[model samples]
Target: MFTSTERIKPDAQTIALYLENVLSHKYQIPTFQRDVVWEKENVKKLWDSIYKFYPLGSILVWKTNTKLESHREIGGIKLADNFHSHEYQYILDGQQRTTFLLTSIYGNKIANKKNFNPTLYIDLTIELTNVTDDISYAKRFLFWDEIDDRDGQIQANTGKKKPLQR
Candidate 1:
């Protein structure tokens, strides 16, 4: 039953490159995949892991000649619907991670949430040089709604007023 199977070498790509593929319609989520439903805290934790150089589990993608209906948008980034390619990579797992990463990097509006901006912002004032493994990342990373705008300066949920430096 597995006669036609072939093992493909695992390829590593930078986060930027992977997202670029997603933007260019090279990577897509199958229509059957569940929508992104990660809460704000989960996203912050994911970023924390990245900031600490912790390994994020591999994102599994299935490349095939078959083209199934895919999502036109992921994490507010619109994909090229008219793209024509001989092969396509459908995300088999890590949909939540992909969506949050895309949304955090490219600030955009998330669907089904009116006036809710999912763009993640980092509190530069936080001293990350001495972060312990048990520390919560909530203070380091925040969503738009989690920020308090006062006097044109963005403050984190902690209410500490730190000057935004560039």
Candidate 2:
């Protein structure tokens, strides 16, 4: 039986490293788990939350000696064939978050809508800050392809509108 003492509070970098080097490449995705389907906005928000040091809830993993058929690739990342071992950590929850973190940080591609994979890019132009009296910070999700079009679209959408008079 598993115990709660195995839980760890690893930092984002450590988590990313573990996913990229150990989990994704070495481990297998259980057959019962669903495919990653997190929206781009959700992924962006997750990154923003991480950037602001917000607490992203812990992920639960099960340690088991039993082996099952595993995924060869996750979120478009290729994995090396790893033989089944005596001990393995099977993810019980938070697969989406973990996949997003890996794809966003390590520059892996995620499946897109048009049968193609696209890389997730964080918009660095907007700065994140905690205003002393304000409750919200600026954050935007923009793909590399959309960066050039954002300004044009912004102007087109906001330029024609006039402020209401008092």
Each model's Cα RMSD: 4.2, 8.1
lDDT of 2 by residue, 24-108 (tens): 4555567688877777667766766776667888766666788776666666676555655788766667778877777665666
TM-score of each: 0.80, 0.67
Candidate 1 lDDT over 1-166, as tens digits, reads: 3354444557899999998888877787788998777887788999988888999889999988898898877887777787568988889888889888888898777665546567788876766645475464777787755677577565554664443456
| Candidate with maximal TM-score | 1
- Position 116, candidate 2: lDDT: 23
Q: Candidate 2, which segments miss by more than 4 Å at Cα?
A: 1-13, 111-118, 128-139, 149-166
For model 1, the superposed segments whose C-alpha errors exceed 4 Å read 1-6, 128-131, 149-166
Looking at candidate 1, the ten consecutive residues that score lowest on lDDT are 156-165
Deviation from native of the Cα of residue 61 in model 2, angstroms: 1.9
**Steric overlap count per candidate:** 0, 0
